[model samples]
Target: MIIQKEISLKPKSRGFHLITSEIYNHLPELKEIKTGIAHIFIKHTSASLTINENADPTVRSDMETYFNKLVPENATYFEHTLEGKDDMTSHIKNTIIGSSLIIPITNGKFNLGTWQGIYLCEHRNYGGTRKIIITILGER
Candidate 1:
């Protein structure tokens, strides 16, 4: 069986946020799936999705710092600055991170590592509520 759902996340500041619980909250159908793959896709270009350390908040903050240094805004060569200084950089960060994640579902739960969690990499200053499409393919 294949179940697809779209969920809108609350607005968040520009940084990496652990959203594993949020995803599970919106995807109750995951509890019904015995074995399958969950595909989580974010419907935005200025943001991204990834999996990383979930235990330490400092890791998230450090990620933001490193990414900012790596892809600083106002590169002078960016032409897509109509939105703001973060426009081009956000898009670039999105590209570097990604737009979706594929995780295995086992025993009605995500088969994530002990310290691994899903992250919503909000690259823009005001990205607003983000939309995520969750596609679950599996059998009961």
Candidate 2:
């Protein structure tokens, strides 16, 4: 059986937001499932999904800084700027980070490596509410 779920999230900042726990907590109420796969997807053009280290806050901060440097907000060579200065940069970031992740599951639980976590990367320079799509596929 494949179960699909969607979650709405409000980010407090303009960067990566750890959301692994929330998705882990909302798996499902099914039984008889042994092996499965968890697919997480972010439904936004200006944002992305990243499965990375979530144990320390510094890692997240450093990632944000790195992306900013990779795609500077006020570069004088962008074309899509009707939204704001961060609009084009946000799109660039999203392209690099991607928008979905697939994780293996065993015994009805996600199979994540040590310190591995799921994050919603908000490239825009402001807080906003975004949608997360969670899908589980397995035997049941």
Candidate 3:
């Protein structure tokens, strides 16, 4: 069976947010698939999707800090400044983190580690609702 759906996430501030529950909550069809793969693709350039530590909020904070330092805004070399100071940096951060994720689904649930979860890396100061396309493929 193959299922495809587009989910819109709520607006979030600039930071790494755990969104594993939100994804599952929107996809009730996942329960029908005993073995499959969930391919989640973010439909934006300023944000990204990644799997990371879900157990601690500090991990998310540290991630934001690290990335901010890694890709500082208002740099003299940034040419894409029409949007805002964070425009170019957001793109860079998205590139580093990526825009998609593929995870195994076993026995109707995501095959994620105990401390792992899906993260919506919002790189802009006010990244509005993000859209994601979820494509599930496998056998029931």
Candidate 4:
């Protein structure tokens, strides 16, 4: 079976945010799947998706800090800066991180590690609502 849905996430500041629960909460179909895979894709170029530490909030903060340092805004060579200083940098960060994730599912639950969680890599300063397309493929 294949199920797909698009969800809008509340806007967030530029950072790495744990959205594991939020994503799972939107997927009622997941409960019916005995085993499968979940494909989560972000619909914006300024944002991306990833999986990482879920236990400590510091991890998220650290990730944001690291990425900002790695991809500073207003670079001289960036041509896509009409949106804002963060615009071009956001795209670069999205490329470095990615725009989607594929995770295993089992017994109606995501097979993530104990400390693993889904993260929305919001790179823009005022990134509005993010739209995610979640596709679940599995067996009953």
TM-score of each: 0.98, 0.92, 0.98, 0.97
Candidate 2 lands at a TM-score of: 0.92
Q: Lowest-lDDT window of 10 residues in candidate 3? A: 74-83
Kindly list the per-residue Cα lDDT of model 2 for residues 57-96, writing each as its tens digit. 8988999999999998768999999999989888889899
lDDT per residue as tens, model 3, 32-54: 89999999999999999999999
* Quality of model 3 by C-alpha lDDT: 0.95
Clash count per candidate: 0, 0, 0, 0
List candidate 1 segments past 4 Å from native.
none
Q: Is candidate 2 or candidate 3 better by lDDT?
A: 3
> Total backbone clashes of model 1?
0
lDDT of 2 at 58: 90
- The Cα error of candidate 4 at residue 68, in Å, is 0.8
Q: Can you tell me which runs of candidate 4 are displaced by over 4 Å?
A: none
lDDT of 4 by residue, 84-138 (tens): 8999899989999999999999999999999999999999999999999999999
lDDT of each: 0.95, 0.83, 0.95, 0.93
Q: Write the per-residue lDDT of candidate 1 for residues 20-110, one digit (tens) a residue.
A: 9999998887899999999999999999999999998999999999999999895788999999999999999999999999999998999
